[model samples]
Target: MFKMLNQMLNRTLQRVSLFLLSVILMACAGTQSPNQVTVTGGTIEGSLTPQLAVFKGIPFAAPPVGDLRWRPPQPVTPWQGVKQTTDYGNDCMQLPFPSDAAPLGKTPAEDCLYANVWAPKDADGTTPVLVWIYGGGFVNGGSSPEVYDGSKFAQQGVVFVSFNYRLGRFGFFAHPALTDEAQENGDMLGNYAYMDQIAALKWVHNNISSFGGDPDNVTIMGESAGGGSVLAMMQAEQARGLFDRAIIMSGGGRSLFGDRKVSEATQESLSGEQYGLNYAEKHGITGTDAEALAALRALDAETVVDGLNLAAMFNPAQTNKPTWAGGPMQDGELITQTISDALQQGNLADVDVMVGATSMDIGGNPFKDKDALFASFGEYAEQARKVYDPSGQAPFQVVGYAVGQDRTMQEPARYIAEQMTSHGQQAYYYRFGTVAQSSDNPGAPHASDIPFFFDTVAEKYGDALTQQDQAAASAIHQYIVSFAKTGKPVSDNAAQWQVFAPEQSNMLNMTRNGDMQHGTDPWKARLDVVKAAVESSN
Candidate 1:
């Protein structure tokens, strides 16, 4: 009996020793690796793929909650030890639009000022960086969408970074109480959404070098509202020198405040203070005092979101008196002038630019009839009809759609290229005209070029994605990779993309058959008419 007892004790001790040894080994292994990096917050360990080292959910700013709500991004709270960042952080608080092209992968929450990075596994600080900003009309969008993945970028030998910014009212509100607070504290007022973007760019400038990216060689790119952000950054005083190049994707290069202007003192059609007051009154919280501000911040995130999404933004039933500010405005400090103002005044950063729109983009269905639509073009009505509908038999709806596209996106794209070329900067213009094999649309729809740019067509199309789709994605992705690496965009797989010059008016077209064609723009007459109308209106 004594011998059996002694033998049992020995086996138990051996087992305990093995368990401790395994634990020690794991702890040691986790302590150091190429997958681990120290960012502004703290040391974070990421995951490794065959091609890249990916770090996700590294907080770049403090959670915009409590008193920090609606304030510019604050410094990230430092952490103690290595934090695992293999998963995505919560996306910015917003009601997800069901029909969104790039759906959020993470849950939406207010504590969501996080950035993600992807770098080649063998990186040693020589790779160029591409920072992506998403678009959901500035009301919705997150960086966690699968279609926004940066693995392909890392595979192609460039570092990619993306982050979330506050959206909707939480991002752009401006209450009298807040204005008073800003005055006292010397903090910037309104346009918190843009403030967040500038902060994110600052973070990238400071931390990208640690992840094998050249701090000096960075390209800022975005789509739709994100594209507008790219344009804004090119002129915003605070954003200068943060990036050296930009790519604007269907971001309208025009005045955001049309005929009206945003002012803090006067309650104009687009007054930020008036909008804030309206919002406060709607919630039964009135007054411009500390108590009012506290009550506003005390509201729950969902109550704050209040069903605001892209669908609700465009819903015809929204006849109620306006509460929220439409979106980002000329805040004077961050966004000193409108994108169009800056482009026209030659205030843009001296950098190479690539700007374009899809064949079909936002802006369709405004006029009641063909006559009204053509007449809206003013002095150019005859020219518009000749360029848009020489046949006089084309479907009014189709003609209306074409007019809207030209007015809002197509003409603006060409005009931006023209301005850039005139400013003596290299400008590359493209028209995404590729129609998916499974899609019945007449041309590429708005936001369809996102997956192609990221080379995530498989995620966007799934089983419906074809060989042709893959080829187009490859061609487009190569051009982007080339642009991010060098100042110029080039792709051996596709036809050479020529620089846009006023003399030639060259633009690259990703044809409906998933091929690239570079030459003079075919719709020059239509765009010229739209340009004349815009200039006359201005």
Candidate 2:
């Protein structure tokens, strides 16, 4: 049964820490593993809050600084002593974000292979482990604002984890120069970020049981690019048996179904090299390929604060074409093939699933206006024609956008749910339609349901909603936690849920009042339309 456990013994390397926050380390004395202080970690020195346990940042691999740069990740050294892991580590290096207008905290750096963890507040040796990967289009992001604090989840008896990986051009660059020195793994170079994620999972498999978590029971969950990373992990052979369940929110894996070839449209990186060389000249730095590499490598951390990012900064070298844009490369070993191939081949691990998306998904804001509505939902649109076509009015465009959201999120959810249901696997689905009014306006947009799904609606600063909000949150949270525990999510009922089939057109809807409804879902029609539209080119 524990067939894939041996994949954990990888390579080792070391790097120091460059944390930003004034890590407020604190540990309660009465707690079980109390008083042993100063864990010797590679990153910061201090303890994190919430769990109140001291953390040590073990480098899953050495910093990809030079020759190691743009390569697959190496393993981390098993050091002596408890490594301090209090402060939030540097984010992966990248161009400035528009959020720069009012930045909250520190930026990032190249030496960005790091992971953060939450040890248990109790001594129970059976708490579930939930590892989180943040999403920033695979480029700019790190765990901050306590968006992923393990305290709440920990309160419910689970170990939470979050961490940083390489990003933008620094993380996924693929080059002819790099592929020559290949490892026997038969994998192409780059995707260091993906490697980092896999390495962290390996670390958890080996060490989490030591921290009050069950090594056998782990769930891999994420949002956006991180969600996409979960998709990658799900499709990987080496990643088999690493996670028992998965929760993917707001990400559809960028539709890389069958197209997984390296394109000649690498003009972006070709141009970026020109830009890199020119920028160096403009800054009075001298260099050749190795020299240029050295110049980029030698620049001070502050000087190398790459300005604004344009295009697919993550794997910029390969994303010059629209086909590969915002998509990860389909290298053989690490990512054997496309998710489509995985589904077709039935390669996904047999695991329970909780998958969903929001009603007020991305295009909702633009839908509020007329012109934008027609532009997207007008007479020419397939979804509009399907829904609003009978009315001959543009109001149907809202249907189209919603359908697109459905296409982008819901259909895949249905696909995964139905796929699992077909194989006798436990599956659960939810639609976040509740509009929680905040201090001023309606609440919970594309990602709004996350707070509630995580049972942090109130913790996320949401105040007393009508009794409806509380009920909805309670029910949803119970369903999720139940899924985590038993690989199944159901209302407090003995009726094993009705299995979903393509012909069945049924799903579960969680209303603001916490009522669960089941039947032929309008989303089913939307899913049919969305799939047809997606299969057909725009």
Candidate 3:
């Protein structure tokens, strides 16, 4: 037994070393250097990898810090020097992530509005573009995730772009402090992050052509919050022409406007004031007047990080807060009332769309029984249990969260298809049902589709995978790349996906076994509830 244990340990270490080696090679490859190119008369420095020209840390907009903290994204101030496009820019200010988000490299800073672009190393000046938005419950994550590396897409003759936006309090918080009468120039309310996204899209529209990308054929893509942002941008009339296509993965956004944001702001302000008062006690500071706000801001970023994380845990968006707690605000400026309402109406971007969700998202809510699921949700408990009967051997918490995911992602994507079909537009929907072979988990788990989508199983999560995994990864990667280059996301090797329309809502349901037919409406019943909520107006 001891010898067996020793063997297992040895293998683990070998795997670890190989993983580190792959990462190091990739990093060094990212910096080995490449020739300079001029896009839009502005030179962009890039690196040459196996088959791609990688440009990292391209400033799409001026950093939103100091005076620009809560302000909308401003235009990028061009520089004369070829800004070394190697390192990733800082992530926008957000609460620290431990519970909700996976650990990426730490880059907690306020000056975080930046972007990166990847294009073919050897290509003409008119490839399609795919702009990616990272997700972390609107409170964490950035454009710098390793999984989102655009090198692959670039190699496939598609221009891939990623950028940073504010998260959590810094991005969505709107107090009476920032919303005075003077700031009423169409940027009056909260969700500056959304504004940042719009700004980045605008930047792409104006500048992508120079990067050998087709400005007219831009596609906005993302997982989770980024996916939700795609929907939001589609709805906003101002953002209609920014992109012609979209791809959403594990789109955690069920509704455009979160119910709990304003109230959460009120709570955060009160909490901040309390923390400031306590801080004043510790320090030889004066009274708890307006100076407290300054003092809180002046506090070291590290000192306030823990406080912000705790405060975020109380927010409704963080999975533990009350259901109607903080989330995307319905402020008229950032979001247009609600994304659902906009979809229902004909006021969304006229573009080809592909939207889907994993079987389970980031939350691992154990669905042990109905009582627990109901206990977690208050009034909606019975309604949730009815759709997801968790009375089986598996916990109801699992079923409840599944239904909740539908409420959050599946239904909305279906609803978008429904809305698009209603408007005589072509839309496609998918459900990633493949579970990681590593674990006995349920259907397509949260963000599990990302590796497949990016075709980076070996690059990202290679630990649990084996030979079969690489083949599957290759197939999925080709599907997404084909989609980006062309409007259709199908390949001879992958599943045959169908467009979503009223007559036949035929869609692809990807699984470990293979893609299956899933044209049936998965959310007709749940949508009825959403409609009732909107109409009840209670």
Question: What TM-score goes with each of the models?
Answer: 0.93, 0.75, 0.77
Per-residue lDDT tens digits of candidate 2, residues 434-454? 655442323236655656666
Clashing pairs in 2: 11-75, 12-75, 39-82, 39-83, 40-82, 40-83, 41-83
In lDDT terms, how accurate is model 2?
Answer: 0.58
Question: How big is the positional error of residue 442 in model 3, measured in Å on the Cα after superposition?
Answer: 2.6
Ranked by lDDT, top first: 1, 3, 2
Candidate 3 local distance difference test against the native: 0.65
Lowest lDDT 10-residue stretch of candidate 3: 316-325
> Which candidate number maximizes lDDT?
1
Q: Write down the RMSD of all candidates, one decimal each.
A: 3.1, 12.0, 12.5
lDDT preference between candidates 2 and 3, better one: 3
lDDT of 1 by residue, 413-505 (tens): 988899988899999999998877989988889999999999999998999999999999999999999999997788876899988887787
lDDT by residue (32-93, candidate 3, tens digit) is 23556554335667777767777777777777765565577777776784666778878766
Clashes of 1: 0
